[model samples]
Target: MNSTNNRIVQTWIDDQLDLYNLAKQLGDTVWQEQIVQTLYNKEQHTQKRMQQDLWRVFDSINRKMLELFGQLKESSNSYEVRVLREQVWELKLQRIEIVKKINK
Candidate 1:
């Protein structure tokens, strides 16, 4: 995964903790919104493989989100359910951000 993306902006998907069970693998500690601005750009001109990698990460996040949605529906109203809903929303935002960045 080492590339210009790592050296300059340091936006390694591994570093996003919200991606822990969502991504296939996870490490490091970056806030969900604290990632670099380049990762938010719609046409950053990254390598084709980089875009593919982001898609893979996005897909993984989507899978986790689907599971969360199922649990949200299956459970009754409560503080725990509210927490799960919040998590689902965060994952939704993460997925959208990934989409915006990978159009290059």
Candidate 2:
């Protein structure tokens, strides 16, 4: 796996931890408002972090793909970068299914 994939996987795992912590905190009454506020803050932070990570990964991938194209010395029309962008989407779907199963 590439560094970008590694980071995305790691971040997804870390987000699971954050989700657990937020859920636990939300169960407290006295700190309910505080917990909500904290969750909101963390949610925003997580979103931004995830977005930045994705941009970095995609940019790096694009650069590497261009480099590969050049390395092959194949005509531009002959070379097509077959990027498997669906892997991440599939992983996300699997994660959601697992979470739903656990909830049930």
Candidate 3:
């Protein structure tokens, strides 16, 4: 992923963590039903956004893989192939993390 996307994902992860922590803290408080419901709605919205982001990442990775495969087919450069393989591995790892976060 590019630096901008990386930053955005990291920021989102941080925000989710903060929200989770807030929910835990509020669990002991005597908040009204409306306040709790609002927080729940916000959490749901965030979750949907995260899922969309993950799908976008997956789509980007798919396109990159396709491009790399085409390049590899056209050239016999071992170094370039190795680099592309490494990038695919990185993308797979990122996908795994995104899946885990979404499951949470």
TM-scores of the models, in the given order? Answer: 0.56, 0.35, 0.54
Q: Could you give the candidate ranking by lDDT, starting with the highest? A: 3, 1, 2
The runs of at least 3 residues in candidate 1 whose Cα sits more than 4 Å from the true structure, single-residue gaps closed, are 1-4, 7-46
Per-residue error (Å), model 1, residue 71: 0.8
List model 1 lDDT by residue over 1-104, tens digit each: 34556643344443433354343344333433344443454135345547777889899998999899899889897987999999998998998888988874
Error at 96, model 1, angstroms: 1.3
Off by over 4 Å in 3: 1-40
Rank candidates, TM-score, best first: 1, 3, 2
lDDT of 2 by residue, 1-104 (tens): 45654675567656656766776777754455555555557645555555665555556655655565564455344324233224334445555554443343
The lDDT leader among the candidates is: 3
Judging by TM-score against the true structure, name the best candidate: 1
lDDT of each: 0.67, 0.54, 0.68
Per-residue error (Å), model 2, residue 5: 12
